[model samples]
Target: MSIWKELYDIFDKERSRWQQSSASKQAIAFELKANLGFLADALSSGLSQSAIASGLECSIFEAKLKEGAALTALNRRKVTLTFIGEFSEFAKYVGKENDALVENAYSKIKSLQKLVAAEPNKSHDLRIKSLFRFLVFLVAHLEEQPLSRTSAKKAEG
Candidate 1:
């Protein structure tokens, strides 16, 4: 019933429909592999999590996802790296595990970069969409996780 699970089923259906849909399957699988720790850390360190989760700035995140999906292979590379750099720097001052947070952010972005880099433009768009869907789900799911919920409670209490 969770959104993440539904999105996951859609991913499976896509892979089945496309047969050897390597790019999409691979991208979606990699994101699904992300541990809860990494997801919590990424939400804490990512620039737009709070805004998107709060429904105040979903537009920017949506625009980025849409634009990245439309970008050519080379431009996707540029956009991915730009995001990596921004997330890396943003993670530095986010909290206690500064180094590890940067590493986590770097790892996530680099994996997406690799996915985007390996596929042609036509297939790359699907790769971007798969990753974007995972991210959107993350933003929403954080609200239901102890990670964000506990923190919010602490701040309130």
Candidate 2:
């Protein structure tokens, strides 16, 4: 199977699992993590294609995909950061009382951004590695949060 197809399947599975489970804050976080994973894979795959095209001296399609992937990655990163910010505000409003968690998430996001900046003209492999690291940190943060009442009910059911 193509890497893109595999990534889509993974994303679908994660989304399905999240929907079947209780839609808790942590569950939402997991969903976001899945999304980030999908984007990372897509971006990496596109970069690989670009590299292949360059090596093979192929047509323009690969270049287009490469450009599109970069734009997609940038947009996704922005959206992810925005979502985290909004989630943090919501946590505060609901009295979830976890400033540290929000701070940690922000820290990871900034770290990922810095990594991208450090290698503006580097290989996509490096970016993919950084993305995986970010995902790991994100998952750890999500795991630390308390499960919602709905999640508990779903688990019991």
Each candidate structure's count of clashing pairs: 0, 0
**TM match of model 1 to true structure:** 0.23
Worst 10 residues of 2 by lDDT: 70-79
Supply the global lDDT for candidate 1: 0.37
lDDT, residue 113, candidate 1: 57
- lDDT by residue (84-141, candidate 2, tens digit) is 3434423332322223333344444444445546655655555455445444434533
lDDT of each: 0.37, 0.43
All candidates: TM-score: 0.23, 0.29
Model 2 segments more than 4 A misplaced: 1-31, 43-102, 114-119, 140-157
Q: Return the clash pairs for model 2, or none.
A: none
Give me the displacement of residue 68 in model 2, in angstroms: 35
